[model samples]
Target chain A: MTEFIPPGTRFHALPSPFPCKRGGALHGARVAYETWGALDADAGNAILIVTGLSPDAHAAANEANPAPGWWEAMIGPGKPIDTDRWFVVCVNSLGSCKGSTGPASINPASGELYRLDFPELSIEDGARAAVDVVRALGVEQLACVIGNSMGGMTALAVLLLHPGIARSHINISGSAQALPFSIAIRSLQREAIRLDPRWNGGHYDNEAYPESGMRMARKLGVITYRSALEWDGRFGRVRLDSDQADDDPFGLEFQVESYLEGHARRFVRFFDPNCYLYLSRSMDWFDLAEYGDGDVLAGLASIRVDKALAIGANTDILFPVQQQQQVADGLRAGGADARFIGLESPQGHDAFLVDFERFGPAVRGFLDEL
Target chain B: MTEFIPPGTRFHALPSPFPCKRGGALHGARVAYETWGALDADAGNAILIVTGLSPDAHAAANEANPAPGWWEAMIGPGKPIDTDRWFVVCVNSLGSCKGSTGPASINPASGELYRLDFPELSIEDGARAAVDVVRALGVEQLACVIGNSMGGMTALAVLLLHPGIARSHINISGSAQALPFSIAIRSLQREAIRLDPRWNGGHYDNEAYPESGMRMARKLGVITYRSALEWDGRFGRVRLDSDQADDDPFGLEFQVESYLEGHARRFVRFFDPNCYLYLSRSMDWFDLAEYGDGDVLAGLASIRVDKALAIGANTDILFPVQQQQQVADGLRAGGADARFIGLESPQGHDAFLVDFERFGPAVRGFLDEL
Candidate 1:
């Protein structure tokens, strides 16, 4: 798996004994990444795009695969962060189940799946891995680093830990730390997976997977990602008319139930349950204030970035707009040129994914300034 | 079970062949009820109190058990809905496990647990049963009927389906119909119960209960019942210090996680999983407009009540204040004296349970006018 890098993707091994934040070390740890466009001679035109929880390295379509990537709309030839003008590199997170080495990875020493033996992950660790990938590409510094959700926290981690590596940082719908509401939501998601008897202490037989738990967790994720207003607009009280009035009342009788079930079923097939558990825990444990010596402002003020942008959605409940405003305030107090933009969309925490028209201009203008 | 009627509690069998809204009939359906105070000479001083998804008929401390009930703060000698001046009747919902004939009950014909064989339930069915209990107490008409959450929906159903049974109705955090957002949430809750392997298609062995699923469902419910603002104020980012730093990253590490776990564990002991599934589906399918041929205003117009109160919490996300305003508007359009009052509190959908100071006076005032 490590020897043959795909045409559009590359793999790089981190330095020996990469120390994880939660007191674990990995040997021969590798990162999978994809790049679009060309790097300048100075290598300063590179733009690193960090992803949220589930996205992989395939950020956009390429000659090798015509299938659109997760951020296909925003990373094309003529889109925001246009490939024609900048070299865009997207790396799969360290504890992700995609091409990256995560909980599903094999332990070199034991010749078994890491599974629960995998080190506890944190946003800082993901940030460190991304920086290693950037350095391996012979890029001394990045022109900008863009992050969405979990990626947003990782970008902030990069600014605090490896300052001066990225001249500009864009944090979208991420917070300084996980709030109680977000923590509670994630706690239930993990419990759903752990409580499944099929899980068997994270060593379940592959044939009988914990699909039920994963599906339930994904259903919850999809619900929280969008606002109630968005659900009302997309699917009102319309019943699933296929079921007659005589059908079981507990069956999926609403259109929203079918919609949630459809998405959750698809998610269970591709995502690894253990990776989800690990990554979600990592997000909850990440506290930028911990790095800043117990003060949120001190932690944010410690960032040495030159320019930054904090974007939030007005209807986002997961990471409310108030947190985004705090990010901009902290960045400004830290002496960085930071601009705050709040998008008015019912898309909620998912505004960045669907509201490209509003987000595209903001990214384009910010990049133009740099 | 019917032989012993606790001091203040009684059981009333509904009229033979009780017809359910969703095309089903119960041959010997019974509702358990508790009453506070005595009826007047004319037998008109009755206040029927309907309950939320949980909670039993024990709404307040009575002669038998001195222990304060769920709403002990707001219902007593001189509290709101004062027992000294008016008769108060509290009934367990039609599909509940607390003394009411529900899924856990043995079918008269089958001689076994009704389980999934129980008829589908609706707000109208619960409302009709409560009215029957009130009539069994020899009260021809009720002075007021008050409901909270699902109980709120039942209150509306009482107004629409059985007009003139109550002269006044108080709806707290209830909507005319379930929204897609709420439907989606309830669907997931039911899925949690049914997906559990122990559920065994709603026929699990009595010894091996589907506690995990029920616990997970209750955890989700407790989280949604409160607001993010309230969670932030109550739990914040406090870590579970009981666990060492080396504790499993996936373990319950936040104060909110512990709180939810404690509540969920207690809930699993008292609430039956199948009853939870059936009632949640009922709430999702209930539509007041369906009672009036799909016209919400017409449904409200069908109510013969003289006065109404629609109460909502400002921070409630499940049933927003906007929906309560619509309730007031629809009732007013029907020529009823309806008042819409939005309580300012972080309690969210559960404000009625805790904000007695704010909710108490409103209920008292509404009944006084009637």
Candidate 2:
């Protein structure tokens, strides 16, 4: 069973023998998504959300799921997204483990798990998979396309590949292309998993899982996800109790280390390591500059939409606020009424998920005006 | 045998069973050092240089070891730290594997490698060991004590523990205490090293060394040592040739990733993993606040020095510029003529090592005034 899925989940059958952007094809491919609220009579009130690296299609609670979601605070009746007025569709990334056709899924031809045999994936492929869901739902044009983190890149890809698919866009903590620093981080994460002997060339079973590698990768991600200011504010020179320290000299001693350990342990079992490697590598390979003859801004300018808002945190070292500014500038250059908002949230790249007090109104204000 | 030691290296034997800051003691412990120029009859021109984690006693070439040193550009006949004008002594940090008593050193008591059995190390222990070397060298007081990176913390400890041991101080990219951000980075690095099966509870022999762990740790260190801005400028969206990409799905693709790989490969075998773990943890455990009633500033105020200069790079995320500023302000609060200088170098924490054009003048100007 997929980890953390909504009961309302629906699968959209992708084109048979679907080809990936980076060469290679998947047979019997599909995408998973969940909806909140009903599409208007004319299918004019639909909004689509693409998530960050780790999230699934479940963005908020619904009568079918009856469970709070990754973005529960932002997407509910009368919430900032306002499910009452706007019908929302959230799709799980194509290369993700949560209810999506990724390396963990069975290869229809072989009747075995895809694992490393899965085709090389790109951000464009995820965007294409998402586009299929929207087209299949009978939504002629989306009211808005909202993307967070990696999803922000996917949103731009959607707007660029299919011009009239989305009326507007909201890019949260996203970039036009991957930065070298980001690429290095993802590379290290992939290395952590690969170096683990238990990974066994991506052939590990649950009993022989690469727990350490996944844990290290998760810890590294958690470290970059939040800002140093937040770490200091949350756990400044705070040592763990002696009982928790254990005898191992290298064991968790600080509160921040323990927090990371807990986070990594919780995530290691839930997410498949091979799936993580593929999704992470896809982000590293995403380059909008490829579309505009080595100009990221030009590539973004090619994305046509009615309006766009690129929002990011000031402390975001991963995607960085500069990228958001670039996204807005390029969208504006392309004739869309685009704007960039940088919040002084100390939470870094994950601010969108946790700093609701600041992000909520900005999202609501943008949607209310639209 | 020690990995890399200069022919000019000299050993200073400490008192038998020397006590550590936290508990336990080391027997038959010795400090390694190298000298440049001759000490004046009055010993008034003596300068002591304490290094960061990886550097050895060989800061510059001498007659016995004329090979170019790690800081070849900075400390020479008429360079910024002019050996022609001052008698300089560079000491390898105590817990490091560079010709110093560390986890890699044999325990005289048991006639076995200290390894995991080595006593817990602290920055203060390194500081005390350096003081012993200075005292044995017949210098009642040093004209200046210069510390870089982790050395910055050691230099502060030198002044705090043994007041008036040095007349002036130079703290480069150093912090009075470890920040939660720094602790998290180091904690992750240690985890990388310890998780490797080859580590084998720190029982690794030369043949079965934890090369992967060390490589991963070194890569993480390199990532933090340099700035993201530098990475973007140096390898922005640059891909390796197809031949170099190889067939591995998660293999190195970007120039930055290759650079890190080459660097990690070069460093992994050079430094012992156990020694790396101990020294890294020492920095994380160091806190000036321990000396000052739960206040870092108060702790700095307690250290008595005639003058101090805390210089750092603006882009240094590891030992951030704010930390150097705090060091200066704290020293000033303690009645020292301390000042802070934040350089506009793009090299991050390693600015002192690479951006000699910028750092040379500042260091020269400070010592010239003295």
Candidate 3:
């Protein structure tokens, strides 16, 4: 289980230029990614697993860490994203912190962290950066591009912005247009961060971080990530402690409170607050139909991918099944080979992460057919 | 629109001793409330409107303020509550700040705000306080007792704890037991206040108030008060000052953000951080079944109220319609005259506040029949 990655595995860094939709260019932007398995001479065997919001290039099994990768259980040697077959590449998105050129990366001219000065990013730029990373690796074509949530939106954007880059795509729990409800929720979280006095307009340097604000933001995320039914079933009105008198003391009172705190603490450590702000704003700004004259089907028609798989969770209130239906319907009307699956899972939008028994097989079947 | 209270209109403060379920006594406990119309000489024409969480005694029509009371539109002269005929008493529950004995009120023994030292409260205690208030008012019986949300729960508790108090009951958007999901949301809000450094374990006196914490709590409340669809339809992803360049150095970027700030600011001014914590915990600890050998229906059966009306919101994910149905079923099984109405409103659990046209008539019709 703790086997190490073969020394033959190669890592690459590609400095790419992304033409942002905001009428500005982000130059000297490099995407760092890793490659496993072997790239066929024609590079047609390449498969890309676009990372989710905050995930980096490390999408494959890493023996040194022993702990499985974010989706390790599904992307290992014998897993759905079989490393033994496809030449897999997972690139850190453009405006991310994991070895990618993001807010934390030094500004070329200012010689300081970009901080608030980082160019505003869009999903188009994120997809464009992935294309550059792939091109730098000398891959002319991809077998399939798979992503979840934000990554899913980026995968679709790639097909629309750069046609024929991938033969097939998998979109999990994502929408073609940013839902107003989703935007509202994200806006509240961003406001929470901005309201923190310590944020200092995103200029807080090596000082006390806006931990409280970040915690609130994560708390909001926790609410959206899972279903209300799940929370009730798991923690309900149960007291955090055995002593009824001390159950709701001046501190953490419920099991769910402690659970949310743990989530916030871990997220604050691994996630850059500035990057979170930028990425969330990018998602909020995403509107495929707007780019295509208010026609969602027309926007999807621009994609020339041969095959696509759109998956949704039944209990996903954030990105509900209707959103996925729109994506599938648009792709079908665009004359693209598309299939949609609405998985019945009580876990809500996060079912993709928790319901691996179903998701694993679906991914495996999609990849095998492709 | 602007008028003074008529010459004959009168107001009174009713104080009563409420016994706690956990033993001992909450002696100085009082239910501060006001009344409109006139009670029959036999004191049988009284209608009790239990105020919701955080609401004060100002639940009925008041001419001095010019603006309508919380339920003024429905409970005025010749209105649904028919103040022209029945005496309506709106009592501020115990552990509340609006003219009632709460954390802000001086502890009889300490001569200071109870603060964190305030004894834990439950919905039963709130109902008991209502009973005391009613008894102290020299009212032998209630024609009808109506409540919404927390108040609804309190009304049900009153029926169970003190039989023959109200001949008829109307519970809107409340549950016999606080669901786990609701408790989880409340726990997060409470944690937000406790985590604030200024909270000082709820002992923060007149010093820097936990404004940030309270703001976060209000933001959390806003999330549950309305549906995601409602927020998106109302605010969407529209920016506050879209014309302003990202380089603009000041102000919120999105309208939703500004909306949330305004809500937070208003909530912080009127709501006490500690009182919010106490009231929220009271709701979380509410479990009628817990007091009745873990039998919720049996507990409801213990109530001997005559006619009962349980109204629920279709979009209320917090206290879903199922909870209301359960209450109605319990009442019906107990041989009580009960009816359930599931109102169609997309305003979530707070629909009772905004959808006055439908709710107003339904409430009025019920009261008229009583």
The CA lDDT at B151 in model 2 is: 97
lDDT of each: 0.85, 0.91, 0.76
If you assessed candidate 2 against the hidden native complex, which CAPRI class would it receive? high
Q: Considering only chain A, what is the TM-score of each predicted structure? A: 0.96, 0.98, 0.92
- Per residue, candidate 3 scores C-alpha lDDT tens digits across B1-370 of 0011222233334343445665545556555677788778899988877767767777655654445566667777888788878888887877777766677677777877787677777788788778777777778789988888999899998888888888999999988888766776787788778877787777775567787788878877877777766766787656666564244433456676567667888777577777788888888778878756788887777778889989988878778888889888888878888999998877888888888887888888888786
lDDT over C-alpha atoms for residue B86 of model 3: 88
In model 3, the clashing pairs are: none
Runs of candidate 1 exceeding 4 Å displacement: A1-7, A243-249, B1-8, B243-249
Arranged by lDDT with the best first, the candidates are: 2, 1, 3
- How far residue A279's Cα lies from its native spot in candidate 2, in Å, is 0.5
Top candidate when judged by TM-score against the true structure: 2
* lDDT tens per residue, model 2, A93-117: 9988888899999899899889889
- Clash pairs, candidate 1, are none
Candidate DockQ scores, in order? 0.87, 0.87, 0.47
Q: Write the per-residue lDDT of candidate 2 for residues B59-123, one digit (tens) a residue.
A: 88987799988898988889999989899999999978888899999988789889989999999
Give the Å shift of residue A226 in candidate 3: 0.7
